[model samples]
Every structure is written in structure tokens, then in C-alpha cells.
Target chain A: MSTTKKAHTTPPYELIYWPTIPGRGEFIRLVFEATGTPYTDIANETKDGISAVLALKDETATTSGDGNPPAFAPPALKIPGQGKDGKALVIYQTPSILAYLGNKLNFAGTDEAEKHYILSHTLTALDLNNETHDTHHPIASQLYYEDQKPEALRKATDFRESRLPKFFGFFERVLKGNEEGGGKFLVGGKLSYADTTLWHVLDGLKFAFPKELAAREKEFPALFGSFYGSVKEVSGLKEYLASDRRLQYSQGVFRYYPELDRQ
Target chain B: MSTTKKAHTTPPYELIYWPTIPGRGEFIRLVFEATGTPYTDIANETKDGISAVLALKDETATTSGDGNPPAFAPPALKIPGQGKDGKALVIYQTPSILAYLGNKLNFAGTDEAEKHYILSHTLTALDLNNETHDTHHPIASQLYYEDQKPEALRKATDFRESRLPKFFGFFERVLKGNEEGGGKFLVGGKLSYADTTLWHVLDGLKFAFPKELAAREKEFPALFGSFYGSVKEVSGLKEYLASDRRLQYSQGVFRYYPELDRQ
Candidate 1:
């Protein structure tokens, strides 16, 4: 209930993730940036702050402290004064973090029904992100892409031919289906975190599979045209995109490998 | 607000998913069964019920009627008279459906913080389920496992050696950390959907990688011992597991290929 704290309020939010490469942390960041809300990117902004993230993934630790369980991975959020007895609340999973902040910042939706729809769409978009990551590391996340090159090549081919069209068509239908949203949004008329999250994934796709995305752009006009392009112009996003804070895509969830792309 | 309806209500929830396998749909079914709540499994119960599922994923249609967007896949839940203007509310995505049912069935948690944690844990369990599936079809979901057998063996090796322990250790720590849960629940003192969702994943893992799981079971006592053994005895789960309603795992996310298992 302490999350009643509005967007611009005190108790600065802390995002715990890897220091760079825009990884899964970027999904959490886009929601914050798109709402113009101030948050501390703990691992990126503060030196030695990544210790907080390391502790989150600490294998020996039983709990995350302040009555929270240890995170299975990074991209966790810590909100001060929001836990039991008014301690800090820590939550992980990119969609879960987005849901918590989206509701607080009014990017969730108009009502409970809209809220779940937005979360569902955000989750679907994240599924695409994970599949994209698998294209480069099909064999094992612990193994480098070079070691898994043969398998990665096969996975990337299926991803470009079948998976990409399936996901793109679904989102395109969602956009066209929502009368209020027209072609610019996935849920309701306004820019919910679903739109923000999907936009970032699309941007990452362009970066990771430029040739494939370029070839398929005209197929899903709603997704690649209006919904994809106009999202960058959304209120707080325009400035963030032009700023240094919008980290470039490298070897995170998305990576650009020429051989992995359309030949 | 419509979800204010509690368990054992008159709504008679309808679950839309493919019949014959405990796929992602089983996550939704567990919360319903765990609470002794009644729900109709559309594709399984009725003779011509697949029409509803087909309509949900109609690729040509932009909207899924009754003001709902088309689902990206099966395993969608429909709550009649729960949407805008009192229409059937349809939602997809395993975790999203589980959260909705868990809350309605009183299996979510006691407070807002617990609710998010439970959902986050459920997502992690589902992530493990997904990785298990990828091991068999390392190259493409559309491709036959035999065609990808070489890659499957390699991926399965990494999964058994690395990923399984990481997930098992994390959940073990979670069970031990929550003093109130005492290795019986993942969140608070009560049985939650997170517990049910995780219990199923562990069950599937045992089926998929029996040799590997047996080898590693002793390493994480909290998980393989108390937590795994006790959840089956949860109020409604015991009866549900005994009944014919519970489908056997076949060619779903968790598949048993001796060649893919630890040898």
C-alpha cells in the first residue's frame, strides 16, 4: 500500500541490474524514462552500487533483506519505505518491476481489466526479447556465441522466418484491434508501459536483426509504421532517446551479429 | 473490481487451452484446483469446444470479440461477465492467468508485496519450464526433436550440469528464508499459486530429467525434501492429483527423452 507514492515523489527508486549494455535493465529503464520519473540506476550511476545487485544474486543468501527473497537474477527494483513495517520493498522480474512502477506512474491502464491486459502484452513482448536472446545463445547461456555458432545459426534462421512473423502479427493485430489506441498503442489510447516496453523491443530487434527487420517492416504496417515510429515521440521518451542516458544496444538481450542476420 | 468475487462463486470460470497435455494451461488449472474452485476446461470438456480457442487465436481477426484482443496462443482464461460493459473477460499468458486466478481463489498472498513476489517466483519457474523445452528442440520449436538431437544432447548437458542447480538452489534458499513458510510455501505462511506453479515445474523436471534430478536432489534438501513432498498434500491438490481431471504430461514443455537425460 505504501506504493501510493506518486511518480515525482520522494523515496528515490533504485534499479538493480548489470552496469551496462542496456540488458533486461533497459525495459525497466524505458518505463521510468517514458514517464519522466526520477529513479537511481544503481549499477550504472553509482560506483560500487553494483554490490547491491551482486548481493541480490548471492547464492548463499537466503533472503534479499528487508523481508524480501533473494532474486534469481538481476533487474530487481528497490523502493525505500515500501516494505512491511515501512521498510524497503524489493521486487525482481522485468514485467513485475514494470507493473509496480507502471501502476504508480499511471502507465498501467484505466482500470483493473486494462491493467491485466497491459501486463499480459508486456509479458508477450518480453517473451520475444528472450527468444531473441536465444538466437545468439541457443546451446547455453554460459557458453559464448562462438562456441554455439552452428546452433545459433539454425536458431536465428527459424527466428527470422517463423517466430518473428508470429510475434509481429500478434502485436499488429493487437494495435489494429484497439479502436481507442488506433495504431499507436497496444492497449488503451494512452501510452502505457506495454507500449513503451514493446517499442524498446522493436528498437532492439532493429539493432540485433537489422536486415531481417528491414525486410519485414512493410509486412506489419501497424507495428513497424505508426506504433513503432510514434512511440519515440511519446512525451518523456523523445528527450530520453536524444540524451546520453538511452544506452546503446551491445551484447545484452539483443546483439548484432552479421552472420546471424538475414543473409 | 469485478474480481472481488471470491472462490466457489457462481461465475463458473472457463479455461481455454489445448487438451491432452499439462502444458502452460496446467498452471492456471493448479490454482483453481488447489482452492477447490470449479472451472470448465473448454477444449477438454465439451465436444465442439475448440471453437472458442480457435476464435481466440484467429490470425485473420484483429479483435477477439466482446472487446478482447486476440490471444497470441492457447491457455487463455475467460471469465464471463467480467469485462468492460459486462462481457466475458479473456486473458492469456501463463503467469497473468495464474495471478488472476490466484487472487480470485485466495491463493495470491496476504498483501501487495507478497502478491508481486509470488508472481515473480511463478515467472521464474515458468522460465525453467521454457529452458527445459528448448533442450529437446534446441534449434527450433517447429523442428522435430530427432532432427535437432545432436544440439539437444549438448543443450541438455548444460541444463543438467548448470541451470538446474542454479534454479533449485535459489528456490531452496527462498523456502528456507521464509520462516513463516517453514519450507512448505514460497511466500507467506499460506499456500500460494507460486507454490503450486513451482510444484508443477519440479514435477515436470523429475519426469523430463529423472536421472539428473535424482542425482541433484540431495544437494538441495529444502526443495527436494520438505517443499517438494509437502505441496502435494495441500488441501485440494491431493484430490486433484488423484482424479482423472489431471492430465498426464506427454509431449508438452516437459518431455522425457532418455537420450536427453543424464546418462
Candidate 2:
């Protein structure tokens, strides 16, 4: 064995989320993946990663950042110090993380109005994501989907028949009205965080409600097909999607329950 | 009738929402009330206000801001011209609106870390709010609460027993860990938008789940009594709460469905 040791480059972002499911971490992951930012996924990289994630919620965990506020939930990011003496920043809340990353990555927006526009879209996408999660866990996240099957059935019905079309229609209108961005992306002509966020939304919705989405495919051809096609073709995102890193949707947000599915 | 006409000061902000119920508008209203900012509550002021609100969603409404993107939903704010030749700005999404007002009102945060901390709190509060809304309208917002009473019962149980405590507990931890702010407010010693937002969350929870919240009152004494008490004592908010402008909780976000309440 060689005595010489190779120098290691610290991954700027340290993502801590449940290793099993993609969940909300996927949103932050997509940003990193699309930008090709090297980051350590704490949970995915080590056996003790899940424990590290859970320890974040513990009030007295013996973690490195002891003084920082404990994240209410996981999918928290530990960012490296910006300056030589700056302290590491641990931030959570999916949209907040995305906004921070967007700012760092320069995909936020060029102008004030554009930034707010992107923020509005990102929040709306999150609203849809929340509703999608509720479709499966309508009663509570603490309870199993099996226990709330009846409630889930009713909630999913509304989600599919009414909420799905309404949300998809809104994005379609956004795409059609993209005069400033030439109708290619949600914000400016170039891809912004909103585009990636929306891409994930559409992808998750399709995974969760294939039959229902297929039934209404023609309604938002520009959004579901053209816009999605363009986003999927982004060189970085394309490679990420094809890689094993893109976890399959299981019991996470946008879960598929046969009983809840409708055409 | 008096012949003399009084000079009118244009309200700097125009808030448009369904007038009969507080709904999400109350969040924005609390910010305005706490700051004593003069604003026009459109739907409450005029019979044609709903028409104005609807026109915003109409693609062919021939509105002044024709090229600007329409709001995805109600509770949209219309900001008057800032400069002599500036055009009005229309923006919506409850948290988005709060952020805009927070920046304009200087209640967001003093520094970058503080701003992101405030943002995390605001988003978490909004998450709780969304879940609260779904407790009643788990099936669909478009459908009547009566139609989803069975589903609502199950969801309300989960919300009361699980979600409520979890969210409140998170806020309590945030309050306890505030060494920098002296534990008086969510962000800093002085009030921020997160403080106002949390006040609404507590108020709405008490209104909707009185028995449950009361039973757990002692658990979050600091949050329920001190933080909430302080926020309520803000002069403008105290007056607003007592005034007729403070709309009652009806079939809105925090409706009191007797059947759904439990200890």
C-alpha cells in the first residue's frame, strides 16, 4: 500500500434526508444534479446517515452545529462556510433550501419582478406537492396509508378530478403566456428553478396518476409535452434522470395507490 | 347632504379576497393591522369588488396590467405606483405576499441568516395552515364541507392529535432556542412577520380545535401565552381584532364544525 495520501475536496453541500424515499429531498437534489454541484448526501452515503438525519431533530444531539436551531424535519442541507472564517449554515424547508440554492446557482431570476414570479411559481408548485402528499396521507402522516384508505379514496378523487386539472391548467396557462421567456421556460428564456420544480411536479404527478394524467394529456400538450420535453432535454438533468440516483417513487409524495387511481 | 368634499388619500395597498370570510386574507390583514398601514380591502368596500377580483383571473378582462401574469388565486394585493410614472404591481400567494410586505415594511430580518430563518418559520407556519385547511376540505376545496364530513372527521382527528402537537412543538423549540433574540419573538427580540404569522396560526387553531388546543395549552405555555399574548397586545392588532373589520371565522380556513372537534 502507498504511504502517500490524496487530498480530498470537501463537497460544498451536505444533504441530510431519509435514505429510503426521494420525498422532498428530490427537489433540492434536482437543483444540485442539474447544476452538477458535488455534494455529500449524508443519508445515502453511510450506514449511520439516517441516524444523523434523525439526530437533527433531537434537541440535545451531539452534532457539530450544536447551537443552531434543530430542523423541524429532515431534508436539511449543511452548507460549507462561505468565507475562510464563516460558520457553516444548516437550512431546511424545501422551498427555502431551493431559494438559497437558486441564489447560489444564479437560476433565481435576473430582475426583481422575475424573481418574485419565480417565487410565486415555486410556492404554487409546493402547494401542489402538499396536496399530492395529502392524497395518500389525507388523514395524517403519522398514520399509515392503509389506516386512512377510505379518507384517501375520497381525497384522491377530488385531487384527480378537480385539483389535478386545475393545477395542470394553471401551468399550461403559464406556459402559453410566457411572452417574456418565449414560452420555453416558466420564467426567462433560460431554465430557472421554477422550470426544474415544475418538471419534478409533472414527473411526480405522472408517476402517481398515470391513467388520470394520460386521460387529460391533450389538455395541456404545451405543458405536459413541449415544456416537459424541453426540460428533460437539459443536458445535466437528462444525465441525472438516466442515472441510478433518480430514485423511483414509492411511498413518498405522489404515491400511487391503485384504489385511489381514477381515469 | 354636505356639499363639501373631503380630500381622499389613496390607500397604498389594495387587498382583494372573498369579503364574507377572513380566509387567507386574514394573514395579510394581520400584517397591515400590526403596522397600521392604510389599505383598501376591495371586496369589503364595494359591491363590484368581487368582479374586480374575478377580472384578475380573466385573460380578456382588459385590465390595466394586461401583460402581467394573472394571480393563481384570490387574496391578491395591488400595489400603487411607487414613483410618478411607475405602474401598479399585482401579486398573490399568501406567503409571497407576506414576504413582499415584510421587505417593504422592514419586518423581514436584519441580516441574511435571519431572513432565511424567518423564511423557514413562515414556510413551516404556512405548511401548518395548509394542513389545517385540509382538515375540513380534505376531499376538495371546490366541494362543500358537508359533502366531506366523513373524510373531514378522520382528517380532523389526525390534525388535532398528531399534526397540531407536532407543529406547536416545533414552534416551542424555536422559541426556547432563541438565545440571540431573548426568546421574546420568533426571529429577533423585535417583532417580525413570522411572529404575526404564528399568532394567526395559534388563533386559528384555538378557533378550530378549541378542546384539543386547550387540553394541550400547558404544554406550550410560552408559545400560547407569552408569544401570542405579546403579539395580540400590539396596539393596532388589538384594535383590529375588536373592530368590525375583523371578520368572524365562518366556513373558512378555521371553521368550527362541532362534529369534527374533540379533546
Candidate 3:
């Protein structure tokens, strides 16, 4: 295991994730891309993707004197100058990572309450994401979609009819209730990470549950506009989505399991 | 609604959660307890507990200009301060609240990465908590555990045999591979909210899946030891637990559905 050289200039920290899966990692990547940060996507190729992912899971690598197995799995970020011996600090968990990045890019918010507001919205977006994943893998992530097809059907029925509407309604309420921002973004007037995350979540849900999301989106025009509307107007985000940087969904958190969707 | 008085001393923030349920609120409550901070727990039996919770969650109140709804749920911390109109700042979301307290108390770690390390571990704890909930209500939270009893049984089988061990094992590795404090705590040498959280997670699993957790604890003795050991030694925790502040797990995230636990 040759050590990767840390960029003297910080060089936007290295991101190690599965190349094929656009699951939670996309949240981090989207932030980097949206901010035009220079980040190296080390595992965006199949040849070494699995190995890179497995290395974290490997006992030898994990048990080595590294910092607590990179704080629990991917989408781990390796900051250049933070750990002992200058070893990169690798932290996982999508919402935490998003919050950290939000703090870094000054999108988290100003006060303690607003920061908590951003976090609350972030957690809500994640709750929606988890429900979307459960729609397909309701039984267990250990089992394939085929193995849990029946369970997925029952789960998706509930998710589409209940959870989807509930979460979408919450987001809609957040937008509509945003007296601070005139019903624009998830938080205050600015475009925080929660807004970006909500956009991705909406995109993922729409891709996975087209009919249901489309029907629900009408009530959340501001939310839809935030993503498909004003967000598209951002040059960096527009450029990133059009470029190779924006990885498509293949094996990520929100996969397109057709059997789980409404006809 | 009558306005309440705010504390001037800013002693640790007051955490109001269900006394018996280790639900969403325990994360914040535990951090406060572990840190030996001066705080209050308005658990289930408090004279105004139910009404206080109800008023916070009231749709009318949510739309009103009251302190941002405490992250829209419980496990909220009423940081003693004045809002725009001399109101207290209510911070919500279990992870967000924990992170806020961790930063305030100095357990969140020394840098951006460490703060994130704590954040990731907290999120993982939440994921584990969610899985425990799902084992009983595998399909959806909207459906009662009784309604999904059949699926819950099957899911708990997987949870006990595979998921619990896998997640517990991961934490064991995390504790053992801790380079900073020689694997003593989750991150650094001192105890973190993550460690406190891990203690509660394992304890809840034990209560819910005693037979399974008992058998598995032997393999991960250090993890179990650190959890039970570290928490027991925390200054205020034992008193808090005995004094009715420590919630019993009845209505929280990791509820014990007996049918799911049975073979």
C-alpha cells in the first residue's frame, strides 16, 4: 500500500468512493463540483473501484494505526493535513460530511439555531433518501432486490403513497413557510447544502419514482424550481452536471428498481 | 401560549425527552448526561411533559414565529438565550444537537476532521437505531409493529444474526483501531458523544435482543467493555439514570417488539 502524496496546497482533499454507485457519495461530489473545488475522485473507474472500497473494509488496513477505520465507511473524505503523521483524515456518513462541507463553504448558516435549522433540513432530506432506498431494499440491503421483491412491493406501496407525500409535503412546507427567504431555498435566503441535497434527493426520487414524484412535484413548485428552476441557472453546477464529474446512478443509495415504482 | 423564562447562567442546555423511550431524544440527553453538565431533563413524568411536547409539535405553533420548531422534533436543546424578540434558541435533530453540545463541551475533537469523525459516528449510531426500529416495523413507520409482525420477525432474524453483529463488529474495530487514544475512545483519548451513543446503542440492542447481544458481546469484549465501562464512569450519568432522567426504551427509536425478538 503505497501512500498517496498529500497536495501541499490542500488541493481540495481526495474523495474515495465506488465508481459505479452514485449513492451517498454524490452528495459530497456535488458540493465539490458546485463550488468548483479541485478534488480527485480516486475510485471513479471500475478497474480499482472495488479494491479501493474493500481496502477500507479490510481488517489489515483498518486495524493498522489509522484513525478509527475512517469513522464508518464511505464516502470517506481524506483531508490532506488533519491527521497524525499528516495522514489524511477520512470521515464518513453523508449528512455529517455534507454539514462539514457546508461549514467549510459557508453554507451551514450564521447562528447556532440557523446551523441547527440547516442540520434539521439536512436530516429530513436524508430521511427521505433512506425511505427511497427502503422502497427497493425493504427487507435487507444484504439481500438483492430480486430476493426481496415481494417485500419491496409492500414497502414501496407505503413509501410512494405515504412517506413520499409526507416528506415532499414537509419540504413544500419548509419552502412555503420560509418567511426569511421568500419561499426559495430550504433554509434562509442563501443556497445551503441542504438545498443542494434536497435537489439531488428530488432528482433521485424522480428517477426512481417518476410517476409518483411528478404527481407530487406540482405542490412543491418552489422545491422543483429550486432544483429544476433556479439551481440550473448556476454556472458551476450546470457545468459539472454536463461534465464527467457528475456520476450517474448505477449502484448508489437510490438505484432505479422498477418493481418498486408506481406504474 | 404563555412565554417561559430563559436561564441567564447558560449552564448546560435543558434537554426535554421522554423518560422511558430511548427514542430520538436520548442522543442529546446522553451527551448532556455524559459530560456531567448542569442541565435538566423534562422526561415523560414531568408535570408539563406531554403538553410541552404537544405544543412544540402543534401545526399552529410550527406556522407561528416561535423559535423555529426546535428542528421540527424532539431531542431539541433549548440553548438559554434571546431570539430576535428575546426568545430562547431551540436547536433540534439528535445529531445536530449532539454535535453542537460536543463542540461546546470539547468532545467533538480538535479539528474539522475530528468534528466530522464525531459527526459520522453519531450518524452511524442513528442508522443502527433506525435498523433496530425497522426490525420491528420493517415496512414503514406508518404501519404499526403489530401490522407488520410477520415481516418484522423475518427482518429481526436477519438483524440479530447478521446486521447487529456486523455493525457492532465495525464499532469494535473502530474502538480497537483507535490510533489517537490507543483505541480507548471512538476518537481521541477522551470519551466522545459517539462513545456515549455507542453505549446506548449496544445497551438498547441488549435489552431488545439480549440472547443475541449476549452471545455476540464475547467476540467484541473491548467494544462492549468500553461502552459499559466508559458510561458507568461518567460523573453525572449514573445519577441521571437513577434520578429519572435516563429514559427507559418504550417509545423511542429502538423499541422492543417481543415478537420480533422471538425465534
Candidate 4:
């Protein structure tokens, strides 16, 4: 058991999330890929690996074992030999995982203040990510898109006209304010998880609403022109994004419905 | 400036948020009150302190100054002498602020694993809080509830019948799994921001959907019977919750709209 973990820094850092669609899992996966950190994407890599993801939020299970409480949702990270008694430490929630990994992987900034700013920005990006999900499923996540078409249309329209501009304008200001970032980073000069997290949401947005994004792309020059383009070219991200490891967007947090786009 | 800050820890921890109504600001307030930490609620206390809150997300401004980037929203924390070159460090996002204060306030769990669990659970509780807000405004936040009444009814129905049960069950199992927690704490043997955060959301749910929460309260005994009731009696929370400092819910995240509540 110890031997397997030693090959990758003595801890098998495993990602447990739904198979396929990038969803929130991509936010966690991006950090590991960008830092060249070795990890296992349980659902995508192994047969029946999705059981691990299911178990994290199993309604009947009181705990996910190893003295860990049951997770409320997935995109949980399992690190062997990291728990209270060298057991696997499992943590769920995208932003929490990103903060933990970001700090450890050096993507969180140098100082304490920068670390939090990175988290603050990462959370805002995730908030936009969640709003994108709500664009198609405004009424309920369990219900089909057809059942909530009218609500989705109204929600998506408001999202495009009002919410997008509000979020985009705020992020643009963040990019423009940081003189050291040169319009690329949201926080300090170097790359942070906040950058990767925001970049993925933008990527998902482009896939989910190309027409709307294209029409509004030029509105926020710093966000679209520099910050969006620059993150893709970052060392490990450049390669992982091009690889098969980067899954396509479909039926997850982001979905491409022509009607939901800028018609 | 130094003299004023010196009285409260040499770095006046100021909470910049809208005056009146708890909204998301209550979550930040609970931590300060829980830990007996000295801080200022800028908008509620000071004359025209709301200008500082307004300036946080100023649409025309590129930055919030003192080297901080433009905040995406309010509930921002301003700490003097905590930024680069003693220029004041400001950060926004509810969970981010909670995580920072949770760690410092001794409300977050002791170890690395417990800390993340507390944060993960806090995020989930905040998710529920956000969902409660959506029950009253499903189509769009900017639109009045009357304009979106039809959709809010549908969303509120799903929230009561489905969403509430799922969240409640998850927290119940978390309390059951931790023997040391004894049904009161969500993580370790002590109370966490996760507990307080979840308590507030439940309190809001009671105010917002009295019938729904009342009918479903007994379904999760450990959560409602123990955890929910236990937190309010805790040291700081007991005193804080009983005082006028504990604001009532009105036109905020947990608004009491009988139409949106269960029949």
C-alpha cells in the first residue's frame, strides 16, 4: 500500500467525480495538471471507479470511512496517508479542494493575504460557474431542461444581459488593477489557481454560449484579450488542455442550447 | 488611525457590507461574535459607513484601493496593517471570509483534514442559504418577486420537497459519523463555523419557510433536535443571538414570503 503511494510523492492523490463532462471536477483537475502533480481521475481512469464518487455523497452512508464524514457532494480529493492516522483524507467541495491544492501546489500566492485573494477570486469565478449552470436549469437541477424551458429562457436572457456583464466587468477590473499581472492574472504577477479556475469557466462559457460570448467578447478588453488567452498558454495547462485529459462540455454545468444563446 | 486600531488589535477588522438585514453578512458576524473577536460592522454602526461598503464594488472604479482588487460583491473584510506595506488587506466572498476567520477564530477544526471538512460543510450550508434566496426569486434577482411569482412557486416547491431533504440528510449523517462531535459539532469535538453557518441557514429556513421546516424538522433528529438546538446555546452565540445585534430577516436572503412557503 505504501509502495504505490511512494511512486507519486508517497500519497495517491485521487480525484473522485462524475465521469466525462468537465463540470466542477475540471476546476480541481486543472490544478493537478497545471502543476504536473500526479493524480488519479477515478471515474475517468478506472472501470467502476465512479463508485468512489457515488460513495462520497451516498445518502445512506454515515461516513466515507477512514474516520471521514460523508461528503455533501463530489469532486473530492482522496490523499492516502494524509489523514489523522495515515488514512486517506477525503475533502469534497470544489473551492475547498482548490484552496487546499492551490496552497500546497504553490499556485496560491506567496503571502497570507495573496493566498486569500486567490481564494476570494477563485470563489467569485465559481459563483459565475454556478450561475452558468442555473441558466439552463433555473427551476430545478433534478428536472429536465424541457420542463423548465420558459424559466430557463427568462433566466438565460437575464444572465446574458445583466449577470454576465456584471461578472465580466468585475473580473476585468481585477485584471486591470494588478499592474504586476499585466492584464493576465487576477491577483499577483504569477499564475494562481484563481487564474485556472476562471479560465475554465470562460472556456465552458465559450462552449455553452459561443454566440453570446462572441458578441460580448470585445466589451471587456483585459479579460478577453489578455487574461483569457494567456492562461491557456501556461506551461502544464497548455499541454493538458490539448490532451484527451481535457474533456468536452456536454450536459453538465454547461450545455449548448441554441435557444439559450444570444438569439 | 493607528490609535483607533490599537484599541482593537492594532488592525481594526472592519466588515464592509450593507446596513440592516443580515443577508450574507450575518455569517461573517457570527464568527466574530462566536469567538469574541473585536471587529466593526462598518455599515450598521458608523455614520455613512455604507459609503465604504458601496465603494467596494463600485462599477466605475478599477480598484478598491490600498492595493486591493475590485471586489465582486460586498461582505468584504477590511483589516488594517494586514496588507502589503501595512496598506490594509481586503477580501470578499462569504466562504472565503469564513475560512480565513474560521482558521483564526479557532472555530475551524484542529488538523488539516478537519479544517477542510469544516470549510466543505460551511460551503454546503452557504449553498443552501443561496438556494433559499432563489426560492423567492427564481427567474432573476433584479426582477421583483411579483414579476417572477409563477417561477418562484415552482422553484420553492422543488426546494421544499426535494432540496431540503437532501441537505438535511447529509448534515444528519455528518453529525452521526463523528462520535466526538456528539451530534453538536459537525467535524471534531468542538463547534465549527460549519455548525454556526448551518445553524444560521436553518434559522433562516425557519423564518422563511416555517411550515416546510416545521413539518420536516423531525426527519433529521440529530440535525434539528441536537445540532440546531445546541449551537444557539453555545457561549458567544447565546449572548449574540438574544441581543438586538442579531438582526431580523426582512427583504434579505431568507425573506418570509408566505406564497413561497409550503401550503
lDDT of 1 by residue, A1-263 (tens): 11323444756899998997788998888888877778889888898998998898789998898989889998899999998889999999998898888878888989878888998999999999999999999999988989999989999999999999999999999998998987998888888989988998999999999999999999999999999989998867888888888888887888999999999
Chain B TM-score, candidates in order: 0.96, 0.90, 0.85, 0.96
Worst 10 residues of 4 chain B by lDDT: B1-10
**Cα displacement (Å) at residue A198, model 1:** 0.5
| Clashing residue pairs in candidate 1 (N, C-alpha, C atoms within 3 angstroms) | none
Model 2: clashing residue pairs? none
Ranking by DockQ: 4, 1, 3, 2
Cα RMSDs of all predictions?
3.0, 4.7, 4.4, 2.7
**Fnat of each candidate:** 0.88, 0.44, 0.51, 0.88
lDDT of 2 at B43: 89
DockQ of candidate 2, scored on C-alphas against the true complex (2 decimals): 0.39
**Which residue pairs show backbone clashes in model 3?**
A23-A252, A23-A253, B19-B247, B20-B248, B23-B252, B23-B253, B83-B87
Task: Provide DockQ values for all models, in the order shown.
Answer: 0.85, 0.39, 0.51, 0.86
Q: How good is the docking of model 3, by CAPRI class? A: medium
Over B26-72, each residue of candidate 3 has an lDDT whose tens digit, in order, gives: 77767766665656666554677666566555543433245464245
Please, what are the lDDT tens digits per residue for candidate 4 over residues B137-219?
99888999999999999999999999999999999999999999899999999988898899999999999999998999989
Query: Model 2, range A115-234, lDDT digits (tens) per residue?
Result: 766778898998898889888888778889898888788788888888888778777777777765655688766788889998998898888888888889898887877788888888
TM value for model 3: 0.90
* Local distance difference test, candidate 3: 0.70
The candidate 1 chain B region of ten consecutive residues with least summed lDDT is B1-10
- The docking category that best describes candidate 2 is acceptable
Which has the greatest DockQ?
A: 4
TM-score of chain B of 4: 0.96
